[model samples]
Target: MTAYDPIELKRIRWRSRRGLLELDLVLERFFAQRFDSLSPAEIDAYKRILDLPDTDFLDVVNGKADLDDPEEAAIIEILRAV
Candidate 1:
């Protein structure tokens, strides 16, 4: 199994914090519960999603927006489930 860098994980966790309280909670929970186990591809997808605008990100999390990338969509599904 691949070991993730602790500093990178911390940076990702910091990026996960969103302006919306609901988003913040969901992301924080996901990071706490799942971040360490994620594959590099999944981690990349999560980071890309974090770069999205707050409105678009929320829409994707809330199931209002559909991601064109399957990898990203899968990651969003996981986030929503959290």
Candidate 2:
């Protein structure tokens, strides 16, 4: 077995189907949990999260985002849970 650094881990994490879809789905579920309905804005927010840099992606999960913004908070929690 080969050892992996953070870069390799991030590359694998970002490309995995589970990592991609699951993170987005988690955010969707979170939105539903909090709002009882998914808003177009929330959907867009999730899409934007998908577009963020891989390092930023990890950071968001690691509690770097400002939780006051629902979109940012949702993305962060979704990533953290995954």
Which candidate comes out best when scored by TM-score? 1
Candidate 2 clashes between residue pairs 3 or more apart in a chain or in different chains: none
lDDT to native, each model: 0.85, 0.51
Q: What global local distance difference test value does model 2 have?
A: 0.51
Q: How high is the lDDT of residue 77 in model 2?
A: 62
Q: Give the Å error, residue 7, model 2.
A: 31
Give candidate 2 misplaced runs (Cα > 4 Å): 1-37, 65-69
TM-score for predicted model 1 compared with the true structure: 0.89
Top lDDT model? 1
Clashing residue pairs, backbone N/CA/C < 3 A, model 1: none
Cα error of candidate 1 at position 45, Å: 0.6
TM-score of each candidate? 0.89, 0.41
TM-score of 2: 0.41
The window of 10 residues in a row where model 1 has the poorest summed lDDT is 1-10
Candidate 1 residues lying further than 4 Å off, grouped into runs, are none
